[model samples]
Target: MDDIGEYIAKESIRYAELIVSKLFSAADILETYPRRGTIVPQFMDESIRQLMVDNYRIVYQLAAGDKVNILTVHHGKRLISNTRHFKKKK
Candidate 1:
C-alpha cells in the first residue's frame, strides 16, 4: 500500500510537470512557426488554426501584420461553445 501511494504521488507530479513543459514548448513553437498549425475547418476561417499538444489545443489566429495572436488554450475534451470572441494574448 505504501509503495502504491508513493508511485501515485510521483506519477501525479510527473504529469503536472509534463503539462507545464508541453505548454511552454507549444508557446515556443507558436512564436517560431506561427502558421505551422492547420486551419480549423469547422470555423471556415483561414486565419484561425489549431495546434495539438498532448490532449490540449492551442488555438490562434493570424492577425494583421502577420502576427500570431493566441486566442485560447484548453483541453481537447471540452467543447468550444463561442469561438467568436476570445481575449487576445501575445
Candidate 2:
C-alpha cells in the first residue's frame, strides 16, 4: 500500500475548524488518511469525498500518488450550492 498524505487547503481548514471547534485533532485528521470518496466518487483520487461530522459535510479530494486534499467543509445542504464558485475558478 502507498503512504497517503494530507494536503488541506487553508480555507478548508478554517471551515472545518469552525464547525468541529477543534474537536478534530491533528491525529484525528491524520487517522483519516487514505480516505476515499465514499459518496460523490469512488476513492480519493477519482473525486472529492464529503464526510459528515455532525451537521457539517467535510469536502475533500485525493490526488494521485497517495495524497489527500481537503476542499471545504460546510453544512450538507449547502455543499452542492456552495461548490459552484470553485468550478468558476477552474
Candidate 3:
C-alpha cells in the first residue's frame, strides 16, 4: 500500500494520500460487512474477496471470528499469482 502511495507521490502528494486513504476506508468497511466484497474470480473461494478502490484492488481473506485479513493491494490490471500468502483453489 505504501509502495503505491509512493509511486503516486512522484506526481502529486495529495493525490497519493487521497488514494491511500480511500483504500484504507474501503478495507475498513469490510470489518462491519465481511462479505461486502465480491468473490475473487481467480480463486473461486468465498472466503477470499476483493474490493476495488480507485485503480487498485484490495484483496483480503475473511477469517474466523469476523476477522478480515488484507492480503494485498495492487493495481487493478495486474494478475494475482500464487504466493506464500495464498494459493489458487483448483
RMSD of each: 7.3, 10.2, 2.2
Clashes of 3: 0
Which ranges in model 1 have alpha carbons more than 4 Å from their true place? 1-11, 86-90
Which rank order by lDDT, best down to worst? Answer: 3, 1, 2
Model 3, 1-90: lDDT tens digits are: 889999999999999999999998998899899899989998898988999997899999988899988999999999998787876444
Worst 10-residue lDDT window for candidate 2 reads 1-10
Rank by TM-score, highest first. Answer: 3, 1, 2
Top-scoring candidate (lDDT): 3
Q: Candidate 3: which pairs clash?
A: none
lDDT of every predicted structure (CA atoms):
0.71, 0.48, 0.90
| lDDT score at residue 8, model 1, on the 0-100 scale | 41
Judging by lDDT, tell me the better candidate of 1 and 2: 1
* Candidate 2 lDDT by residue in tens digits, 26-86: 2156345646335454232245566666555666665576565666655556636434533
What is candidate 3's TM-score against the reference?
0.92
Estimate TM-scores for all models.
0.72, 0.49, 0.92
Error of 3 at 47 (Å): 0.7
